[model samples]
Target: MEYRSEISEELEAWERKITRKSSMVSRSAKRIQNRINGVIPERLHSIVTNSIKTMVQGVLVGSTYTVHPPKKNRSLQVRDQQAKELIRKYKRIAATEGAGTGAGGILLGLADFPLLLSIKMKLLFDLASTYGYDAKKIEERVFILTIFQLAFSSDDTRRKSYRKISSWDESLSQIEVRKKYEEHDWKTFQLEYRDYIDLPKLLQMVPGVGAIVGAYVNYHFLDWLGENAINAYRTRMIKEENQTT
Candidate 1:
């Protein structure tokens, strides 16, 4: 009986240690997420916002200028330039002390950033493709968007998001919500605008950097998108607001 009792006590102690270790890991992850958010600036948020706008414009142009290669060419160049600028701005932000210095540090600084960008790009690419844009051009846009996403984002989370966004099969038979703009039956398209499109739009309404991160994630990441990314962005924005205020 005494031996059994001692064994029980040892098991309980081991469990307690495991629980403590788990708690520490959770806390550390949260702290790391918070730190990453703190490093990204409002300007990076603005870049996200601007990228969404550019994407929207691209969609509109792609829908209306289907046959005109010259016009499409100009529009594509403009969008590309804007995307490049946004990437540049993001790089500047990532280089700061808040964003961390070394590769590992930078990875830590951009935990959720890639996810947000991936979501945004997925939405934009789908929208453009649905509007009768050339498949090659759509693919090009996807590639460019992915590059921009990677330029500003680091970490395993971001990389995974990129892979998810890149791999999304928009060809699946799903419902479509934007009937007026769509060429095919709503039922033919496997995804509804609300699922892949409007959700991103709603996220864009969030104020300041929070909306930016939310919108980016909504448009780019798809299934890989997580609330944790938005939460991390919000926490960082709050910290910045507090510091400035």
Candidate 2:
């Protein structure tokens, strides 16, 4: 009971943190991203959008990926511990992949886009399981992906995504998340994702420093995604407890 209270307080604090206004640094970074977007060609953008569209479906929905079965009926604290451990495990793998590809220069650096994305989705599946949610369900998969968007997006985008999942217990039943996933806005999703990481990923392709940049960038990316997933799931679990009590 005491642990639950502590976690509830933590969740409330996290909620406030995310809802806060965008910092000047974030605003300036978005402006820089806008300029970068302008410089990139539409043809390249189309290619990227199309490619990631297929990749997202395969990774998030396909049966190819499997999460090891987690014991059921665990307490929230136990689940939270498992989630953190999974994140640490995957973070190392992502960092290694990033370094290997980054050292290969432009071609390999390009490969890291899908590679890093797959690693994230994989982590989400494991996380869902730890939290006693089944990722095999289409709606659960969509929710998992939204957590990714929440982590990587701009301040405004993050807020919008956060609100959609804030009351997921009621909202999931109220809306057709499955259909929403089917008709997802890949172009916008990919655009926001690319813009967010454009500079560091761009620098990651530079011959001499590519490896170091890739390692650093990918490590932090997975870390960000993992943290958001934990908080999102924690919020949902807490909501369920409150309703039942």
Candidate 3:
């Protein structure tokens, strides 16, 4: 009970942070991203969009990408501790993948995109299981995508994504909940993610510094994603709990 109360307070504080107004630096970063998008050729954008679409589809449909069996009836504190351990485990895997590809030059660096994405999605599945959810459900997968976008998007997009999931039960109920997973805003989702990490990832392709950059970037970015996933899910879980009570 005491732990639940403490977690509830943490969620309250996290809500305030997510809802806060964007600062000047954030606005400027968005503008810069817009300009960069304009500068990049449409052909390249199409290629990236197609690549991400294919990669994501493969993971979503692949047989090997199994969800953790749901942890039935666990307390929130125990669940969260397990989730944190899973996140840490994946973070290390991502860092190692990044270093391996980074050391292999441009080709390997390119490979890291899909590889790291798969790792992140797998971590989300484990986290969902720990939180007593089944990742096999269509709505749950959509929620996972929402968490992914929340992790990778720009400030403005993050704010919008956060709102959609923050009231997840109500928001999810409004959706048609297709089993095919075709309704997501893939274009905007890919664009925002690409633009957000473009510069650092681009530098990661450089020969001499590639390994160091890849390891450092992947390590930190996984940590960022883990933080977002935890807080985002916790927000929904807390909201649902309050309603039930």
Candidate 4:
């Protein structure tokens, strides 16, 4: 009971973080980012759209990351500890991959985008499984993408995404989630992610700076995602427990 209470406190703090309002600086930055995106050519946008679509599609259908079965019932604290370990391992993998590609110049720097995305999706699935969630479900898969959006979106978008994630289980039945999976706004998903990450990742294409930038960005991005995923799942778990009790 004490352990559960401690976790409940941690979840409360995380809830505060995800629900906080956007600041002026962040709003201004998002405005500038939108302006910049507006100036980019449509041809390039189409190309990027196709690329992201393909990458995400491959992961969705691929069996590479689905080997692990969902873990059985465990205490929230035990699940949290195991999730931390998974994050640590994936962080190292992302950093190493980033360094290698970043050192290889423009081509390899571009390659890291999809590679890192794949790694992130895989880790999210693994963490879901660890938390006893069925990763194979369409709703669960879409939830993974929602968590990704929460990590990479601007403040306004973050708030919207957080609401969806917070009430996800209540918003839709399993049948509804599965039936409406194809209705997800994937274009918006890809664009927001690209826009949010473009600056740092673009810098990773430079010859001398690419290597360092790549390693640092990948490491921190994975860390951010890991934290978000943990909190998202924790919130859901706590809510479910409350209902049952």
**For all candidates, what are the clash counts?**
12, 0, 0, 0
Order of candidates by lDDT, top first? 2, 4, 3, 1
Q: For residue 52, what is the lDDT in candidate 2?
A: 69
Error of 2 at 3 (Å): 1.4
Q: Name the regions of candidate 3 deviating beyond 4 angstroms.
A: 21-23, 41-43, 55-64, 172-175, 179-185
State TM-scores per candidate.
0.23, 0.92, 0.87, 0.89
Higher-scoring candidate on TM-score, 2 or 3: 2
Q: What C-alpha lDDT, on a 0 to 100 scale, does residue 37 get in candidate 2?
A: 78
lDDT of 4 by residue, 122-162 (tens): 89999999999887766777788779879987667888878
What tens digits encode model 3's per-residue C-alpha lDDT throughout 1-245?
68877887777776676667768986787788888898888876886777677756654554546887788887777878887888788878988888889888877877777787778777887888888888777678778877887778777778888988877876544246454356666777788888777777888899998888888899888888888788887777777888899
Segments of candidate 1 deviating more than 4 angstroms: 1-44, 55-140, 161-245
Q: Which whole-number lDDT from 0 to 100 does residue 61 have in model 2?
A: 58
Rank by TM-score, highest first.
Answer: 2, 4, 3, 1
What TM-score would you give candidate 2 relative to the actual structure?
0.92
- What would the per-residue lDDT of candidate 1 be over residues 1-245, giving only the tens digit for each residue? 34334344544453243223235764465466555545657665444445444443354344522322222333322433443444444433433322121123323323333334334444334333322344335433433333333323334324543443334343222233123224433221211222233233333444443434443443343322212222222222333435687
lDDT minimum window of 10 residues, candidate 1: 186-195
Q: What is the lDDT of residue 55 in candidate 3?
A: 57
Error of 4 at 41 (Å): 3.0
lDDT score of residue 103 within candidate 3: 86
Candidate 4 — which residues are off by over 4 angstroms?
Answer: 55-64, 174-181
Candidate 2 has its poorest 10 consecutive residues by lDDT at 169-178
User: Which lDDT values do the candidates have, in the order given?
Assistant: 0.36, 0.82, 0.78, 0.81
For model 2, state the Cα shift of residue 112 in Å.
Answer: 0.4
